[model samples]
Target: MALTGPNGPVMTREEVDRTLTRLGAERDAVEASLLALQDHPGRRLLEGAELSGRTRERWSEAEPGLGLLWSMFDTYSEALAAARAVRSRRARPGQSELYEMTELLRGRGVTVSAGQLPQGGLHITGSTRMSEQVSLTELVERMNTWYGRIIEVASAADAVWTALPARIDLLSAELGRVRALARSVGVHPGEHPAGDALEEMAKELAALRGEVVADPLAFWVPRPGAGTGAPGGSGSAPGTVDTGRYDRAARTVDGLRVQLEDLLRLRDDADERLEGIGETLARADATLAEARRARGEVLAKIASTEVPAVPGPASAMRERLAQADQLRRHGQWHRLGPLLDTLEGAAQRELQRARESLTSVTAPLAIRAELRGRLDAYKAMAARLGVSEDPELIERYDQARRMLWSAPCDLRAAEYAVMRYQQTLRPTAGPGRNSV
Candidate 1:
C-alpha cells in the first residue's frame, strides 16, 4: 500500500522536510495571533464591561471560541510535533517512517474530544462523538474561522468605545455651563423654550452615553465589504461609528447657546432701547398737542368746516415700555425681547397718526388763508388796470374782503365774491377798446 490519505501519497524525504518547515512557521504565526487576541484592549474591555443588546448576545456566543482556539492550537502543535519526531528518527526516513509522517501532517490523524468543541466554535454537527478525528489542515482552518468571528465583535465594540464616549462627556460639560448661564438670565425650564430644550438635551446625552457604553456595537456601521477586507483573515473591515444622534444633539446645544448670547446682548442694550422708545413717545405727544391747538384755531377762524379730532398721547405704548424696563431690571430677558419689538412698532405708528391728525385739523384754516391771498392779488390787478374806482369793481372787492378778513370766514362765499371781483376787473368790449 502507498499509505495514501486525504492529502494523498506518502511524502519523499525532501517533501517531508519542506512540509515540516511550512507547518512550523504556520504554528508560530497562529500562536502569536492567539496571544494578541487575548491581550487586545477591545477584548479586555468587553470582558469586564457590563454588556447588553447585540454586543451581549454576540459575546455570549463568541466568548467560548477563545477557549476553543487555545485547545485547537494545542492539537495543531501536537500533530506538528509528531510529524517532526517521525522525521527525526532517521537522517532520511524509510517508507514506514515516511508514511507515518504523511499521516500526521496530511491525514485525519488529530483527535478532538467533544468537550473541547464549544457549540459556537467548530460547529461540528453530526451524530454525537466522544472524540472526532480531523486532519491538521482542517484544524488550522477551524482556528482561523473562530479567530475571525471573535475579532469582529471585539474590534467593533472597541471602535465605538474609542469614538463616542469621550465626545459625549465633553458635550455634557458644555451643557452644564449653558445651564448655569441660563439660570443667571432667568431663563428657567417652563419659562423659556431654549431652557427647556437644554434640559431635554441633557437627558438625551446621558442616555446616549449609557447606550454607547453598554452596547457600543449598536452604534457601529460596518463598511460595505467588511467581512472580506480584514487582513490575514476574513472578518469585518474597520468601519466608522454612527455619530448621527450625537451630532444632532451637539447642533441643538449650539443653537441654544446662541439664543442665550442674544439675551445677553439684549440685557446690555436695554437702557439704550428704552431711551429711544421714550424719545419717540415724546415726539408723538408733542405732535398731538400741536394738533389740539390747531383744532381750536380752526374752530375759531373757519366757518362751517368739519375738523378731525386729535387723539391723546400714546399712553399704552409708554406703559409697555415701562413694563419692558422692569423686566430688564429683573433679568427677564426672554419676556423683554418681544415687548421691546412691539413697543418700537407701536411708537412709530403713534407718531404717524399724530402727524396725520395735525394735517387734517388745520386743513380748513390753510384754505381760508389761500383764499384771502387770492382776493388781495385780484384787487391789486384791478388798480393797475385803472379800474380801482369803478363802482361795481369796488363793491365786489369790499364784499370779498369782508368775508375773508372776518372771524369764522365763510370760505365758499369768499371764493364766489373773489371770482365776481375778478370778472369786474376785465374791460367791457366796445369801439376802439379791443377788450382791454
Candidate 2:
C-alpha cells in the first residue's frame, strides 16, 4: 500500500498484511499446480511405462529432477509457515518480523537436498552431492523447469498413441471385409496379384499396430527445442504422430478394394457374354444346315453351274467357349474374360458366313426363274402384236421353255435361247410394240 526505496522500508501495518496475503495466494496456486502435474494422465503413463530410445534416456534424468522439485517445494512451504507464525504473534509486526518476511519472500531461505538433481541436462548449479539454498522465488522457477521437461516427454508419447493405433484398427477391420469379397470373386492369394498384395498389406498393418502399442514414444515428433515451454502453458508442447506408416497402409487397402470391385464387374459381364455366344453359335450351325439343303436343290434343278459348299460349325471357336466355361466354373475370371471376347467375335463372324453361303448356293435357281419369266413375257408381246403364230418366234420360245422346265437344265443355254426369242419377236411386233 506504500511505495519505498529499494531496501529502505520499515514496519507498517498495511504493507506487511498485503505481503502476507500475496504470499498466501502464491502458495495456494503453486500447490494446485504441483498436484495437477502429479495427477496428469500422461505423467502417470510415462511413470509406469518401460520406455526406450531417446524417451527412456531423457526420462531417466528428469525422474530425479522430479524428486528434487517436490523436495524443494516442501522446504518452501515450511519456510513460509514459519514466517507466518512469527508475524501472527502480534497485531502489528515488529521490525525483526518484517525483516524476516522480506528475506523469506525475496532472499535465499529454502534448501534442496543433495543427489536430488540429475546431471544430464538440468539448469541447476551446485556440487554433485552438496546441499544448496535458494529463495522461494528461485525454487518455484526451478520446479517449473523440471515440470516442463517431464511433461514434454510424457505428452509426446501420449499424443502418438492417441492418434495412430485406433485408426490402424479401423483400417484393419475394413481390410477384412475386402479380403472376404476378394475370395468370393475368385481373387485368392497366389492365384491373383491383387489378392497377394492384400495379404501382404494385412501383415504390415498388424506389425505396425503392435510396434505402436509397445513403444508409442518411438513415433513421437517433438517441437523445435528443449525447454521452450509448452504451448497453452501445459508445461509441454504438443507433438505429431508419424502417420506416414498408417497412411500408406490405408492407401494400399483402398487400392485392393478397387481391384476387387473391377474383378466382380468382369465376372458379371463374362457370364452374360458367354450366354449370348452360345445362342449365336447355335444359330450359325442351323444356318449352315439350311445352306447345305439349298445347295442340293440348286444342283438338281439347275445345270452348267457349280455351288460353293456350306461351312461347318466353327470348331476352334466352340472349343474356346468350352474352355471359358471351364474357367468360369473354376472361378478363374481373369483368364475367362479375354477368351470370352474372342469367342463372341468368332461366333458372330461364323453366323454371317453361313448366311452368305446360303445366298451363293441358290444363285443358279434364281437365274433359271428369271429366264422363264422373260420367255413368257415375250410370248405375250407376240400375241398382242398379232405375231403369236410367227414360225421362228414360236420355235425359239418353245426351246427356251423346255430348257427352263427340265431338271439338270443348262441355265446358260436357256438364257441364250430366251434372248434370241426376244430379238426375232421385236421385228414382228414392229417399232411401237418392241419388247421391254
Top candidate, metric TM-score: 1
Estimate the TM-score of every prediction: 0.80, 0.66
| Model 1 C-alpha lDDT versus the unseen true structure | 0.83
Worst 10 residues of 1 by lDDT: 228-237
lDDT of 2 by residue, 1-436 (tens): 5434234555365766776787678777767766766776667777887766666776775666666667767777898888788778887776667776666666676777655443455444444657767777666666666766777766776787778888999999999999998988888889888888988998999989877765777787765554535212555546577798899889989988987887788787877888899999899889899989989998888777878988777888878888889999988876776677788788899999988888888888878888888888888878888899989888888888888899988988888989999888877777767454
lDDT for model 2, please.
Answer: 0.77
Residue lDDT tens for model 1, 1-436: 5666556888888989998999998999888878878887789999999999998988876777788789889989988998898888999688889888888888888998665454444343422768878888878777776787688888888888988999999999999999988887789999888888988999999999999999998998888765522214433336799999999999998888888988888888888988998898899999999999999988998889888888888777877888998898888999998898889888889889998999899888888888888888877766666667888888888899999899888888888988887776665222454242
Off by over 4 Å in 2: 1-20, 114-129, 223-232, 265-270, 279-315, 334-436
lDDT of 1 at 353: 93
What lDDT does candidate 1 reach at residue 106? 80
Question: Which pairs of residues clash in candidate 1, taking residues 3 or more apart in a chain or in different chains?
Answer: none
